[model samples]
Each structure stands twice: as C-alpha cells, then as structure tokens.
Target: MTALRKTTTALISDAAPFAIRAERASDVAAREALLDACFGDNRHTRSCQRLRDGRAPAEGLALSAVRQGRVVGTVRLWHVSAGGIPALMLGPLAVEASSRQLGVGAALMDHALAAAKARGHRAVILLGDAPYYARFGFSAAKTGELSLPGAFERDRLLGRELCEGALDGAWGMIAPTGAPLPKTKASRARKALLVPRAA
Candidate 1:
C-alpha cells in the first residue's frame, strides 16, 4: 500500500513537521476552535455540513495534526450513501493559518484517507476545490448526477473510489448513513410502557 494509504500513524516527516494521529475526545474543543479560526463561523452553513449534522464521523476516520501537543489541523469523514452506493463524505478539512505552510492540511488528508481505506471504506466524496483535491485523486467527472441537500457549485462535487469502480454507478443524493445513536434505558422503558398491552 502507498504511504498515504497505509495507517493513521504514518507521518509526513519531510513536508510536515508535526505528527498526525486519530482524533481523541479531548481534541474536540481544540479542533472546533481551530476549524473556526481557519474556516470562520460561516462554515456551519456550507453544503457539506448537511451530511455531517447530528451524525458521528465514521469510526476511526476523524484525524488531527498535532504539534507540541496542540491540535493544528483537523479532517473528518462521515458515513453516507452516494445515491445508493456506500461512500464516505469528507469535509470541513481545516488547518490553522499559521500551520498552513507546514503541509499540515495535506498530511491530515493522507492520514484520514489511509485510515478510511484500512477500515474497508469503498469510496469518498467531497465538495471542494477540484484543483486542490485533484492531486489526492478526487474528480468531479463521476459526481455529476450526485448532489447535496444545500446549494453547491457543480464542479466542486468530487469523488475518489478507494476500490476500482466503487463509484462508477454511484449517483443520486448524498445522505447520512451513519449509525443512529442507541436509545437510553430510560427512553426504552418509556417506549415499552407506551405500547398497549394485549387484553
């Protein structure tokens, strides 16, 4: 496997001076704060956020770049059905402005995609600059018929198939497919009581 598709621990030692790793719960605030600094408050109103809303990222796919123990970059992939095909929606990739020149963003992309492939994910789609993501194998050629819930530029809808042909027939709406959170015991009990008892 290529270095970018190897594992989460793989480091971009030459281009990036920081370490890339799986994101932890403790990194949430720092990550969110970093994203805000990079993308600003308007980020939540973007088209990609529709798929990420109220959904958890694919297990083991959220990643962060750290330097001196502080989060400087973040990227996450969410479980979604590209039309009818299983795929992951990559989004909200952001790196601190101060760290941009250090290649933290690219390194985070590599680490996250690698972890996704290792986890057996078949495809990944994103709404981003075609020119930038093209280097990572994303293209809009196959995503013409696919769309997001909110408005987005057509040419910006890009996808990359982890396995050959994974997205060949993928067409339609991109909707969240992440597992729903389990009901709490109290909620289950309440639901059970609400069911009418047979006479």
Candidate 2:
C-alpha cells in the first residue's frame, strides 16, 4: 500500500469540529493551493481528472471545510455516469497536514457525501484506499466492472450507492455527464466584445 493509503487508513479519533459550506469564488485559489499541498500537481494527471476536465462540479456539490475563516479542507463531487448510471465522482479530499489528525479530512468526506445525497444523487465513485473509504460505505464490490477513460488501478476504484441498489447493474466506462458550467459575467463580457464582425 502507498504512503497516502496508509495515512488515509490511520483514522484520527478526535476530529475537531469545523464549519462546512458551499465553495465560493474567492475560495478557488486557496482550494487549489490546499490540493497541491496535499496531492501535489500530479493530481491533474490522474484518471479521474479526465472526468472533471472542463466540467464544473455537480451543481452545488463543491464544498470546503473552514476553520476561523481559513479553508482548512476541501472535497468536491463531479457529475459522471457510472456505467450509464447517473452518479457523482468524489475526489481529492485534502486537509492541511497540520490538521490531518484533527479529523478535517473525514469531516470533509462526510459533508460532501451528505450534500451529494441531499441533492438527490444516487451513487458516488472514487479511486482511493479501499480500507479508508470503506468507512464511508464505498467499496470495490460494485465497481469491479466499471472503468475509467485512462489507466487506473482496478483495486483502487471504489463506489457507494446512496440509494439502495443504485449500482446493482451499473457496469461500463465511466463518462462525463455534467452540463458545462455557466459562464461568469466577466467571461461573458469578454466574449461579447470579441464577437466577429460581418463584412
């Protein structure tokens, strides 16, 4: 098992309480920095990134664990089809190293999953330690036949069905299923000025 996998399975017992909320525009830089600190730049090259590339997170599914106004942890669920079954992909759950033993990572996972369920999502998939994610109900039992667009460890692919039997027959390649994120006003304004002129 990898060092990360070991760390994930450590299971901190005293997780300090933190406020969970929807991610905001201003949180982007901090969130990216946090992810880099935890997962490094290599995170973008992972197989799961293929599903998230150019796609906005599932509506209202990106979240942050904040402490005293600082973004201490983060987690997001992206829209994906688990073998044609509409589901969310949870990933890159990270916390400040100093905050690891305090339970921030676990809190973030719980918050993200609950939020996904509240949004009516039926299932969630991820590639991580089976021993760690199993605590939250994710497992390889239902994901044995599912595959990612890029190469990945078959054993690391895990999933959990929020609604019973959501993954009963789910099998095939996982594909992006989300609508493009809405353009911000600033982006729209820039595009409006770049409109082509007719001769």
Candidate 3:
C-alpha cells in the first residue's frame, strides 16, 4: 500500500491526531477562511457547494488538520443521495497556501473517509482532480451513472466505495438535500387547477 493508504488505515485503527472528530460550529469561521484563501471567493458557485448547502454531514464528520493550535487544513463531507441511495459527498478540501506540502490535507481526507466508513456510509462522491484523489481509491469508473448540473470535466466527477460494491446501481442528478425545487408560476397554476373551491 502507498503511504497515503497506509496512513488512512492507521487513522481508522487508531484515534490519533488523524482520528476523525466532530467539528465544532465554532470552527466554521476559521475553516471558511482557510477555504477562501485556497479556492477564492467564487468557491460557493461550484456545483459541489450546492450539494453541501443545507446538508453538510454532521459537524463531527467535518474533519480538520491542526498544527500548533492553527487549523492548517480541512475537509467536509455532505450527506446526499444518489439515485435515491444515500451516500456522502467529499469536497472543498483546502490547505493553507503556506502549508501545502505538510500532509495536512491528506490527513484530513484520510480521517474523514475512515470515519465515514466506520459510520456505515457506503460510498463517497467528489469533484476534484483525478490524479490527486485517485491515491485514495477515488475513480471516474464508479461515477459513470452520476450527473451534475453545471459543466464539468467528466473525468473529474469521481466516486469511491467504502464498502465492496457500494456504488453499484447508484446514479442521479445530485440535488440539494432537503431543498425543494423552486415553485414556478406554471406549477402553481397547475396546483391551483387541481384544488376544489373552499366551502
């Protein structure tokens, strides 16, 4: 196994610095700032953010990498369903520009993924560079059935199965969890036509 895979296994087996922990709401500001610095202001406009908006997985799964009391990197997983099958979405992983080579980002991802597996989340989907994420077993082959709203490099949409065959038959347009589609005037008119007059 590669060092990254080995470290990921270790995180799952031992609750050390790489162990997954609950992210406190207090950590949001700092985490967001780190992400902003990494991805810039337009980050929220990305399709991944739409998948995360109201359905970020519990803070406990929002893992971070801290060094000497500073949050050097972070990773967040969001709860989502693919083809009506529940799965997790991994994204916006960011490391401070100055800390790029320190393994903080990898550690956070390893810890969060192990935690997801332990918690029974069977699969994870993410939009990111295939070469980098492939080290963790993420691949475009598994995401063949999934789709996104905005234009994206098809190979960039990737998936990983935490359990054997977890993504089989999983396919869908990733919609916001708990978010209702916008009510259009035409739909409202249809609804009005269906209702009986009030007595």
Candidate 4:
C-alpha cells in the first residue's frame, strides 16, 4: 500500500487521533505544501487533476486533520458526473509522514464520506488501491463503464455509492460538473487592467 493507503497500526492508547475539521482558507498554503511533500512536484499533471482543474470542491467537503494546530492531513471531494450520474470525485488524500501510524488517513476518509453523505451527495469516485479503500465500501464493481479524462489505471478507478443504486447504469466518461473556482482578486484585477480603455 502507498503511504496514502497505509493500514492503521496499533496506536498508542493515550495518543488521540488527529482532529478532523473543515479546511480553512488559512490552510491553503500548508495543504499545498503537504500535498507536494506527499505526491511531489509533478502531482498536478495526473488524470484526477484534470477533473479538478479550474473547479471548486463540493461545498464543505474539504477537510483537514490537524495535530498540535498544524495541518497534517487533507482530503477534498469535487462534484463530477460519474459516467452521466451525479457524483463526487475524491482525491489526493494525504497525511504527513510523521502521523501515518495514528490512523489519520482512515479518519479523513470516514469524515469526508460522512460529510458528503450528510450533504446529500449520492456517490463518490476515486483512484486508489482496492484493498485500502475496500474497508470503506469502495469498489470497481459499479465503475466498470466509467473513464477519466486522461490516463489512469483501469482497476484503480473505484466508486462508492452513498445512496444505494446511485451508480446503477452509470457509464461513459466522467466529467467535472462542479462550479468553477472563483478567480483571486489579484488575478481579476490583472485581467481588468489588461482590458482596453474606452475610446
């Protein structure tokens, strides 16, 4: 299993798991740094990035696992059309190496799924190891007919239906259906500066 898919080891009885919470805007930098450390610099070029490019995650679905007030883990889900069925795409679940054995990854998965369900999302799709995600009910059984925007391992594309039968008959290419991420004020102002002045 990859670092992101690590099995929980026997945790110290007094050592509480990292606390999970909705990610704050302040976590933006730390989260990116953690993701880079976990997935390296080239992480943005992957197939899942295509799904997330220029989009916002599903409302309230981005979570962070914090320890000692430091963000140690992160997970986010984005809205997508799972082969024509409405679904969320989960990705880039990352935990700091120092916290791997504390069950941070599993906690993030559970919390993210719960939040997604509470928000009325029907299903979630992700590319990850089957053995690791299996405990959470993710499988390829319902995603056999779905595909990503770019190269991806066929077996790694997995889905879990939050609503039973959510994925029934879902097929074809999965595509992003989330709202576009809002442009930063600096970027928007830069664009305005570039506009031609009235004659």
Candidate 5:
C-alpha cells in the first residue's frame, strides 16, 4: 500500500511498448549476453560486476526490453550499503547496439527503480555519464559522504534519493553486502569506483 508499491504496480500494469517482465534467474544468461554485446569485453572495467557481488538485487528488480522475444536492453539494481546504510545501486545498464535510441534503456530503468522504491529502498547510486541519468533525478552526490573502492573520477559517481534526505549523514566505504575484496585487477579497478570516505 506504500506509494512506491502502488507506483510499481501501476508501471507493471502499464508496461512500455515492446517491453516485458524479466525473470530473475531465467534471464541471467540472456542478460549477460546482451551486456557483453553492448559493452564488449571490457564490461568488467565498468565496475558492474563488483557492484552486485554479494548483494544482487531481487530478480523482480531486474528488467529487460524485449522485441520478438530477444532481449534488446537491460537494467539491474543491486543491494549495497553506503556507510552501512542500505541503498540500491543501479548499473550495468545496457541496450543492444542495434536498439540504441529506442527508449529501451529508459524503460528498463524506470521499471527497476520503481520496483526498488516500492521495496523500501531509500536511495540508489551509480557511476555513469551524468547527462544520461539526470532525467531520472540522479545528481552528483559530491557533498554526500560515500566512497567507492578504487580510483575514479569523482564527478561521475552519482546518486538519486528515493526518499528525502536519504543520503544525509551517510559516509564511509560503499561495499557489497557480504563479499570480500575483489581478486582480479579489473575488479579492483571497478571496486575503486566506490571510493571509501575517511572514517
């Protein structure tokens, strides 16, 4: 009965054109393939893998854009903690090369975020091109006390507050819920995107 739940239900009932619900486990393979095609081999460098390590968001929060039953775009939100404060982290958003500009990515994002908010997630974070995510109300959290794991351009790390003052007093390393430090160099680089704040 919460606003988020009501909104999410409404969104689902009014699914966008050419969009369909994504099954959590059933869609992983296709989603991964779509991500590979969209991001190339360097996808891991984007910090996507690390973002969802131990706290992958529920399957209901992951969505895909389909046409003729083929996934053309996808978006995923992960459970993460910023300074131990719970939040959803959005990323690895990808749209098929052939499907760019078709509103596929936007649709997926809208669906996933509404679901997260409905589930009581107070905020979401991402390291992405600002111009693209701004339409969703994401803004630079430069003054917000949260940090990523490795070296990253500070400006690109952004957040959206689903609830007012969600990021207030939140500072510290943003980490996967229960995972250890990344082992590979690529993962290390991606982890750095979540710069840790001084304790």
Candidate 6:
C-alpha cells in the first residue's frame, strides 16, 4: 500500500517540503494569488470557469498544498453535467512557480481525486493537457462528443470514470450543475446599495 490511502493524502518525504491537505478557509488569499501568478488575470475568462461560476466546489474535494505554512498549490473540483450524467469538473490546478519542482501539482491532483472517489463520486471531467492528465487516468476517449461552455482545444477535454463505465453514453454539452452558493451578507449589502430607493 502506498503512503496515500483513499480519502486524503499528506506526502511526507525527507526531500519534500510541502504537504497536501484539504483546502482551508484561511488559504483563500494565497491560493488566489498563486492561481493568478500561474494562470494570469484572464484565468477567470477561461472556458472551465463558466462551469464554476456561482457554484460551490464538491464537498471535501478542494485541496491545497502548503510549505512552511504558506499555500504553495491549489486544486478544486466542481460538480457538472456531462450530457445528462452527473460528474465533477477538475481544474485550475496551480502551484507556486518556484514550488512546481516539488511535485505539488501532481500531489494535489492525486489527493483531490482520491477524496472525490472516497465520497462516491462516479466520474470527473477536466479541460487540461491530455499528456499531463493521462498519468492520472484522464483521457479524451470518452469526452470527444462533449462540449464546453466556451471554446476550448478539443483534445484538451478529458474524463476519468471513478467507477467502472461511469461515463458510458456520456455526451453532449458539459454544463455547470453544482449547488449554487448562498448570498453572503456582504454581497446582499452591495446589491441593496446598488438599487435606487423608490421615490
């Protein structure tokens, strides 16, 4: 058996500096900055972001890699519909530039996927480099007929069925299907402030 089991992973090696763990509320700012530095400001305009807008990530699937108490990597999987089939969307996996050499990205992927499967998720879809994701069992073979909300390189769309044949007959558009986030108090106040009072 490997050091990583099913639910979560925290790789500890004498040479490794970071540990993989479930993303915490306090990691938000650092994770966002790491994403921007890795993906640039236009990251939100990407096709996958459409599948995540106004939606919350699947429970217990978001992960972060921290080194010396600093968030050095991040990954999150959101719920989406693969045609009519329920699935999760894995994406925007980013590691701090300098920490990329520490294998943080791959560790984050492994931990997140294991957690998703442990939670009984059937399958996962992602738009990423087929070469890199292939090592994790993601492939374009089952996603050829699926479309994203915006333009994407066809070859980059991929899926991995956690359960045998989970993605069978999966086709058509991949749309956001995650639970909607409730309005936060700050958001409610901002919206109310934008409204003009009735005269």
Top candidate (lDDT): 4
Model 5 stretches with alpha carbons more than 4 Å out: 1-17, 45-48, 142-144, 178-199
Give the per-residue lDDT digits (tens) of candidate 4, residues 112-187.
9999999999999999999999999999999999999889999999999999999999889999999987788336
What is the lDDT, from 0 to 100, of the residue 158 in candidate 6? 92
Model 2: what TM-score? 0.82
Better of 2 and 4 by lDDT: 4
Per-residue alpha-carbon lDDT of model 1 for 123-190, expressed as tens digits? 99998999999999999978999989989999999999999999997778999999653456335433
Total backbone collisions, model 1: 0
lDDT of 3 at 165: 88
lDDT string, candidate 5, 50-156, tens digits: 66654535546777788667777788777788887787778788888777766777877888888888888899888888999899989886325677876666777
lDDT of 3 by residue, 71-155 (tens): 7778878777777777788887888877776666778788888888888888888999999999999999878888877777788
Candidate 5 local distance difference test against the native: 0.73
Off by over 4 Å in 1: 1-16, 181-199
Give the per-residue Cα lDDT of candidate 5 at 74: 83
Off by over 4 Å in 4: 1-17, 185-199
Local error of candidate 1 at 128, Å?
Answer: 0.4
Runs in model 3 deviating more than 4 A are 1-21, 178-199
True lDDT of residue 20, candidate 3: 29
Question: Which window of ten consecutive residues has the lowest lDDT sum in model 1?
Answer: 185-194
1-199, model 2: which lDDT tens digit per residue? 6987767645431244567789887787678778777886587788998897667888888889887688988888999999889999998788888777778788788888888888899999999999999999999989999999989999999999999999998899999988765668446533543565344
Between prediction 2 and prediction 5, which has the larger lDDT? 2
Which 10-residue window of candidate 3 scores lowest in summed lDDT? 13-22
Local accuracy of candidate 6 as per-residue lDDT tens digits, 115-185: 99999999999999989999999999899889998889999999999998999999899989888867783
